[model samples]
Structure formats: C-alpha cells, structure tokens
Target: MNFILYSDVNDSSISASLGRPEYSYYFVLKAYHPVLESLGRVHVAASVADVDVLYRQLLAAGEDSVFLSFTPPQKTPVDLQCPTICVVAWEFDSIPDEEWDSDPRQDWTQMLARHGRVITLSSHTANAIRRAMGEAFPVLVLPTPLWESFAAIRQQQLPTPVNPGTTLAIKGCIFDSRTLGLSADALIPVPLTPEEEAVLAAELEAARPPALTLKRRFVIARHYLRLWLLDAGRQQIEPVPRVKFLSNWYWEGVRDLLPDAVHDWLERRLRAICAAQPLPVAEPVPLNLPDTSSVVETRVDGVIYVSVFNPRDGRKNWHQLITAFCWAFRETSDATLVLKLTQNDLALYYSELMTLLAQLTPFACRVVVMHGYLDDAQYARLYQAASFYVNASRCEGLCLPLMEFMCSGKPAIAPDHTAMQDYIDDSVAFVVKSSEEPAIWPQDSRLIYRTLRHRPDWGSLKSAYERSYRMATTQPLDYRRMSEAAIERMQHYCGFSEVQMRLSNFFEPLPKVTDVASATDNASC
Candidate 1:
C-alpha cells in the first residue's frame, strides 16, 4: 500500500532550510518510512495551499500515488477532486481540547459537504469530526506522530557498550549513517557478506559525503562510539533511560519532529520505576533548531521576527502584536520584535506595526522597530540571541517557537493554552494566563475551529498555562534545567524508539473506515 500525508507544508520547521511547514507531514512522513517500506512506497504531500492545482499537476504527470490529507478544504469547490484521505489530527490524538472553541470553523459550512472519510488523531477528534459533519460522516483517529529519520539517526548516535547494537542496513544516507551510529564500513559497499555490516557499508558509500561537514561529523565520530561502548560495558548497572526533547526554528516546526507524546509517557514511566532510586538526568537533544553559528543567521545590526499570523483581527491584532515590542522595551529592552505580517514580509509590516506600537503601551517610546524582511538565517539568529521569546495569542495548534526557546536553552513566555501545553513544560519555560484583549488571535480561530470540532469546554488552557509557568519558573530560569527538562521530556516522549511501540500498535490495524454517504444538522443553522 502506498501512503501519502498531505497538509500545509508551511507548518514545518524544516521548510525554511529545506522542507515546507507541515509539521505533522514531516513527522508522519518520517515515521511511515519503515511502515511504508514494509507495505510499499509512501508519499507525503505537505500542506500545499494550491492543493487542487497540485492535484491536477500530479494527475497530469501520472504519478502512481496515494495521499493522506489532514483537514478538509474550507470551501467545496465543485472541481475539487483528488486521490486522498482527509484525517483531522484530533484532540485525543494526545492534545488537550479545552483551549479550542466550540465553533472553530463552523463558518466553513460549504467545505464539510466535500469531505470523505475524516480521520482523527484520536477518538477525541473522531467524535468532534462526527459531530461537526453529522452522524453520516466517518472519523478515524490516527494518533501521535511516528518516529521519523531521528529514530534511525538515534540508533547511530547511541551505542552503549552493553547494547552495542547494529543497524540492519536497508537504506543509505549521511543522516542515516550519523544517526544510526553505524561505521563508515556500514555506510557503503552494501555488505555482500551475510553480515549486516556488509549491507551497512554499501549504503554509506552510496550516500556520498554530506553536503555539509557537520552532517558527516557522526560518521567520522564512529570510532569514538566503539570505545564508549567498551567503557559502558565495564559499568555494572544499566544506564538510565536516555530522555530528550527536540525543538527547532519556528516552535511549530519541530512540535512532533521527535515524537514527544510517547517520550513524555516513557519519562514518567521510567521515573515511576526509579521512584525507589536515582535516575540519570534526561539529556536535551535539540535537532534542526536555529543554528546561530550558520552563516545564514547573520546579516548586520538586527533581524526582524514576526511570530503572529492568521489573527482574527488580521490587521488590528497585528497592531496589538506589535505592542508586544513596547513591553519588550520596558521588560526585555535588549531585543526587538519585528512584526512580520506578510509571508515574505515584503510590504513592511514591521514599520507599520512600529508606528502603531509608538501610539500604545507604557514603554512605546523605548521601543524601535524596523523592516527588512528577515531571511531564515537572520531570523534564526534573532530567535537565538533574544533573552526570551513571547507568544501572547488567544489560541494555538501548538505554540512551537516556545520550543525554539527551550531548544536554544532560553526561557519563553506563552499564553498558557493549546498545543503549547504539550511540550513547553513548567520547569522549562515561563507561562502566562490568557491576555485580556478584545482581539481574536489566529490560534483562537483554530481554537474556535477545535471547540467546534469536539468537547469545547473541557481543556483548561489558561489555568494550565498559569500552572505550567509556575512549575517551570519556580526556580531561576536556569539554562541547565531548561535543557535538562527539554532533554528529559524529549527523550521520554518525542524520540521514535520511545514511542514506536505505541505508534505501531495504534496504526498496526490500519484504521478500517468508510466514507460518510450522508449527514444531519448538528449545528445552529
């Protein structure tokens, strides 16, 4: 069976450097590798906005493909047709539902007409999907993200002397060799011998030298792993369960990049096991976060960073978001919040936002804003350099950039709600209750969309944020704790190995669902 994951590619963190935004798309794509290989070739489509046009292009090209779409389109275009399954990553898919509103997207009455078999990440979303589309519609829960490239990469990076495992070579790539902890002998020369090492060698040679030296650093560091494992073997006791968390550029970029849900479970599980004893501190394994050392993150005095998009008050909220900078001047005073309004930031949203900031807030005069459209390199650096990051929105799918702060070993303050609760633990960052503004933020729309999707009043996001912040900031915002909790949570929940068993079981019996051929009115029409 061919598998394809479709969603907005812009949702991913990798896209700024390589892939698009679709965070789940990347996670699922990465996770499905083994399963897809077991079944057949799996293809994923990032949230391509022009899906219909892209659909036609693919059809014209005659690519034998199957696709898995995430959410349904907002409007029912008569011409909208494609070979895809629309699955809504739901609340029970391991995310809290309280932060979302009951009528998240009730406005899109036309789109529900075209939906096929709607899949939820969990039963939470399944019920919501059914409620929204009527009893006639079908919803299946897909669950949390599957292990992606990181799992394989992990095997390479970790080699306990006792558990000096070997890679069963099936593919070759710089990342594979580095992450899998395989030696150069294993990367290429496709082991002609019956031994797995032979297969690994052939794969490495085929993978070629990485485009970047750092990419090959692990491959080069292979020699050290052998010695470390030797040292590990001499120790009597087994090492603590290695825990970790992964974060990246935009917080949303790496939300599920490391499979944090399962990681979180495993950490608590191991902690429970260790309740009678001491355990090793979980290690923070930050992947694909902003690499400030990279040449791209540099370009002069300041870089403009825009964290807000798709606000309920598109332009007006843009005005309030800019006001955040005014607070920054009094509170942070070191960094600037460049209001990035447009996708490309070409229209100078920062300048206009600054003009508005000047008119509002106590520290308006102290703040200065500029516009120059920050590229990935520049923005990544700014995100890195900032003393703290801020996300004062009403709603969120998962406030990812806060993860960026944690990943970079910096503290952040987010409105306590939505997916932000999933990863940003209280011990790792600052959390604040919801802002008392009249404006509806972008995530609020998603919140509204979610509320409409399921049990709307259930999740207490504002309270969760306040509590989480208290938890994270009880002590000084030490970089060590941030990194430690980040690593611990990431290791326990986000890592593929940590969650593979759960994911495999959940997806083992590929959801057996049929299309809803009919519907009834559940909304106030």
Candidate 2:
C-alpha cells in the first residue's frame, strides 16, 4: 500500500546520550525503512510545505498512497482524498476533560478526528486520546520516530575533564519562553472564596514574624518604594506606599509588613496607587543567547540542561535531581554544583541566596557558581564529567531538565508539588513534600513555626532535601537500567509502532481513497 511516512525530529541520529530529539535513531530507522520498503510506495514529508510538494510530485507522477503520515502532529492537514494519517509526537497530551479540566483536549480530538488516522508518540497518550475522544477516535501508537532519516554513528569523544569541585551547570528556562522570545506574564492573583480568605487571614493572625524577616520586609518595601519613586519621577505615577502582613512568602517582603485584618484593603490601595506600568525606568535586558536547553548536551558521567528560567518553578530550582554512575570513579567530594546566574531583578535574589549559602555553608566546598552567561560546550563537558543534577523551585510546569535526568537513568529529588510528578514517580525520582513558608513568615521543615513552642521534628521538606542530596551523589548507579526503563516506558506509550498501529486501525475502517484532493474537499468535513 502506498503511504506517506513523516518525521520532524530535529536530529534523527541523535546520540542516545542525548535524551531528546526522539529516543534512538537506530530504533526509528529500523521501524521506518522496513515499512517503506514493504509498502507499495511512500512519500516522506516533514512540514506542510513538504506535504504540498510531495502531493504535487505524486499527482504529477500519477501515484498515491492509501495511507499518509502527516509529519508533525495537530495541524489541519491539507485536504487529502486518501484516508490520511496525522502523527502527534508528544509523550503526553493533558487534554481538558472532567479528569483533565485544566488541559486542552477538544482541539486534539477535533484535529485527530479530521485526519482519517491519528498517531501518538506514547501509549499513555493513546489511551488518553481514545478516552477523551469518546473511546472511538481512529488512533494508533506509532512510537515517535527517534531519527528523522539515516546516518552512520561517529566515534565518541572523550568526556571532558571536570575540575574537581567545579559545579555542574544547573540552569532553568521557561519551556517555550526563549524559543517564543517571551518573558512570563506576572503571577496572576488566584481567586479565593470568602471562607478561604478567612482561613488565610486566620493563618496570618496566628503567625508571628520571624526576627530578621522584619528587616527583609523593610528592605523589600524600600525596594518597591524606590521603584515607585523612580516611576513617579520619570513617568509621573504614584503607587501605594504602605504594607500588608501575610502568611505566604512567594509574595512576601513587600506585601506582608501590614496587619492581617486590613491586608486586602492595603493591597487594593497599593494597586490603586501604582496602576500604570511601574517601570523601574527600563525594560529588563534581554538574554543574548538561546535558553539553557539550547546548550543542553550529555557528558561522560553526566548530562545537563540550563537556563535561569523560573523562580517558582520547582522542577529546575535547586533540590530535586539525581546522579549518573555509568562509571565507578565518580565521588561526591569530587562533584561540583555549577550554577549560572544573571543579576537581573529576580536573579538578584540569588545574590541574597549566595549570602545565605555562605552563611549556612551547606555542602559548601562542593558547590560552585559561574557568574554571568557561560559557554555551552564548556558547561556540556562539565556536565559530562559531573555526578548528578537537582533543582529547588517550589513549583513548575513541564520540566525538561528533570526529564533529561530521568532519561539518563539518574534519580532526582523534587518538592512533592509541580508538573514533574506527571512523568517521574518512585521508580525514577524522589518527590519531596515541602511547605513554602521560610522565605515568607519563616518556618521549620515540618510546616511548623520555627519557635520552640510550635516547631516539630522531621518533616517532608527536610526529607526531600536529604533525598536530593543522597540521589545527587549515589554512586555506581545503573544508568543503563534507568535509561532503558525510561525508554521502554516512552516507547510503550509513544513509540512509532504504537502510533502506526493506532493509525492503521483508525484508517482501516475509512473508505478507500480514490484521490486525496477529492477526499479533503468532500466526505470527511
């Protein structure tokens, strides 16, 4: 049968050391070539433009396929008379249904339903797709092709020698920010019911200020006041000059200096004061290079992804991560913690963090910071020779770096919250449940007041940190086993065969195609 085999993987020959760009080209070439050779004919395409060219070429030659694989998934494929197959190369699609109300699904179903055949990257996705599409959307599980085409493997280079105690590059970037050339929109205030508001008020009322925290509040207030004054001078604007006390740290310092009973009243007054774009005089300097992931590459004993992407992002912060031990020589004392930080406003907070690290000296000698932007290849080699990775953010969206760690078979530690829980579990990484308070009102590890009267013993936060440290240095780990398991899981759910089978079944029941052009113009709409 004639078919269109499509793949848009950026690098088909992506080395297994690299966790993405599909899993393995060897698997992909093996799966795709056999199908193409056995099929009567196959038109290979990557983009919609390529699709048009291929169709023209086929029509000019008076040839057609009973099947088609739209290279990239989720596009309205140019109307094809033949029952067309559309492939989506994502591991999981969190669609919005009752079960996934926060995700987007109806569009996914519509896109797939329109395509006579739909292919998914993993089994997890296939099941979800079927369930979301009323359990009857014509779909298949063709493993996401690892390689787009073919190539011979190159001799591997020696792993870069990491300076003992030199930090591995640990950076975070928003998933699509750099690629999208965008900054995150400021945090939107979540709505709370009156009952929830009352509870928060009570928590604040019951809370007592941690000692130095008062100084931090004043400092932050001075900060906002400075910005407010700057804008008032330059832009002729005014912002509220008061404070509100709160039990939260994420928005602490500036907001929590006021009494609890009138906190909301103060915030509303502040908003009224600084309604205009409160410019501190200029826009934040844009990062000069691509995000940290752009420079991500696997090293001999380690792999790294970088970028100072998010603060609330728990996935890449500083806590949850594991180490690689394909080699027996790695020692924790010899391991380094390389952190790339820019001194922008949010990153400036890291300056405070540096002071904190110096004061606490927790794991002092082993941690290293490379200030300013760094060389990618330089860091890639550092990562190759390093032991493991970790993040300390309190929240996150899709976590690519942690995935890179797991794909490498290294364990990781993450706060129990965040988007990371979606992929990693007990088998792959450690999830730490922690409270977000210390930075705001100050608290102990057990979600208790640090004072003797309220403080409790060991809590999830402390446990998570301990787990992170342990996994970060775990030697003699089974990188291959971890990597293999991840591969199997991904393949079972997202591999090319899984997608092809689903697509095949989906298209099998569709009316045979005389011509794709005619098919698109008629019947399926």
Best by lDDT: 2
lDDT of 1 by residue, 1-525 (tens): 345565444344533422112344444444435644554455555444454455445545554333455543331222334444454432222222233356434333234444444444344445545655667664444433322422332233321111111211111111111122323243245535567777787898888744424444444345444545665567547652322111111122222334766546644675442222346799855333222222221121221222434222232234434444443334432233433222332232333432344344434112322222345444444444343445555444433344443444344555444445556556655555443223222244553322321111212333432333333334333534554565455455444454445434434444322222211211110
Q: Give lDDT tens digits, candidate 2, residues 301-349.
A: 2232232333322223343221221011123334334444433233534
Lowest summed lDDT window (length 10), candidate 2:
147-156
TM-scores, each model vs. reference: 0.43, 0.44
What TM-score does model 1 achieve against the real structure? 0.43
lDDT per prediction? 0.39, 0.41
Candidate 2 residue 479 C-alpha distance from true site, Å:
8.1
Distance (Å) between predicted and true CA of 278, model 1?
A: 80
What are the candidates' C-alpha RMSDs? 29.6, 16.3
